[model samples]
Target: MLKDIVDVLADPVDGTPLRCADDLSRLVSESGHSYDVARQGYVTLAGGRGLNHEGDSAEMVTARELFLSQGHFAPFVEAVTERVAEVIDKSHAPEPVVLEVGAGTGYYLSHTLDSIDGSRGVGMDISVPAAKLLAKAHPRVGAVVADAWEGLPLLDASVDALTVIFAPRNPAEFARVLRDDAEAVILLADQGHLDELREPLGILGVKSGKLERMMRQAEGYLELVGDAELLEFPIRLDRASIAAQVGMSPSARHVEAGVLRERLARLPEFMDVTARAQLVRMRKS
Candidate 1:
């Protein structure tokens, strides 16, 4: 899978082109920098200092896989795949490359790749655990452990479409890597998402003005291609699904495990909760 996207990768230190080494187990840069491919099949593309923060832990990644596999976020995944298909159809690139930043477990990336023909993906996340799962999530995807805050380790204008779902975005770097007509499809969680669980679970709520702040940040480098579309749906979740949802989110980090369990025990067997997010399309300015 790494072989599919090897030509698009760049050296994290100096931005030199990269190639597979003699045996193809390592990636070597034009400037002679070497990065070993992990036995699990992913590569870490951080610079000399290495990553500052671990994006997600193995527990979190496992919880995410469990929660998503249940299809609780089917609407979100469908919207992402639909938008990517539209972007690819418009571009008409014979073999389009889709890069997903902060791609947790490669769920969305794999789904999009399945929907489009002749499409490959780069699943970039800072978490090594997440990268390990992403590496094997699909046959057409290449997983890389890299920070979203840092510039993406990709060649200039190399991507036909980029996707960021419930993750960080670097608009300037996205603009540089995306082709002229390519778009960055972002799915941002809005207020009222998980409102039913917030009070009982004692977790944080979505802050107001989050989307507006994101648009302001992307003003110069990326422009909003269209109005943001809100995708809201309700799901009947059991206690286990509720636990997995909380455990995979930032809320998991704030609350103590025992306390969360105690609270979850008091809830009904099934709950009707809203999953809300905004899908926005942006293009290079």
Candidate 2:
């Protein structure tokens, strides 16, 4: 699987090209760096300091898999795939390289790959637990464990399109890795999202001005392509689904296990919850 998008990967230390070596068990960089490919089929590309962020834990990844597998976020996935397809068509790349930062479980990435023929993807996440699933998420996907905040381990102008689904982003790094005609699709949770669960589960709500803050952060590196689209849908979630949703999010860390369980038990067996987010498209400035 790593072979699929090996051309887009680079040495995290020097930003040089990397090739498969040692019977495809490791990636060797042009500057003489070697990174072992995990037996699960993913590789870790960190600089000398290595990864400072542990990202999501095993339990959180498992909870995410459980929640997503139930198709609770189908609309979000579909919207991302549609936007990516539009970008690829505009670029007219015969064989495109798509990248997903903080790609958890490769759910959204795998969906996008399925929609585009002859396309490959590199799913990058700092979490090893998430990378393991990402490696086998799709036949054409190459999974990598890398920190986005430090810098993306990708060659300049190597990516055709990128996607970030409720994940961390580095606009500067994104601009460096994207071609002149490339674009990045981002989905962020908007205010009022999961409002019903916040009060009961004691989870934090989506803050206001999230998009404004992000636009400010991308000021010099990238610019918005067009108006952002708001997608709002309602889902009927049962108690189990509610718990999985909370467990997969950052709120899981703040709420204790006992208290979260108690709050979940008090909720009705099935309740309607709103799913809201803003889908933004941007390109290099």
TM-score of each: 0.99, 0.99
lDDT tens digits by residue: candidate 1, 1-285 = 899999899999999999999677899999999999999999999999899999889999999999999999999999999999999999999999999999999999999999999999999999999999999999999999999898899999999999999999999999999999999999999999889999988998988777899988998999998899999999989999999998899999898989988999999999999999999999999
Model 2 spans with C-alpha error above 4 angstroms: none
Model 1: residue 70 alpha-carbon error in angstroms:
0.6
Candidate achieving the largest lDDT:
2
Candidate 1 off by > 4 Å? none
Q: Write model 2 residue lDDT over 1-285, tens digit each, in one string.
A: 999889989999999999999888999999999999999999999999999989999999999999999998999999999999999999999999999999999999999999999989999999999999999999999999999999999999999999999999899999999999999999999999999898878899999999999999999999999999999999999888888898899999888989888988999999999999999999999
Worst 10 residues of 1 by lDDT: 204-213
Error of 1 at 97 (Å): 0.2
Q: Which residue pairs collide, candidate 1? A: none
The alpha-carbon deviation from the true structure for residue 189 of candidate 2, after best TM-score superposition, in angstroms, is 0.7
lDDT of each: 0.94, 0.95
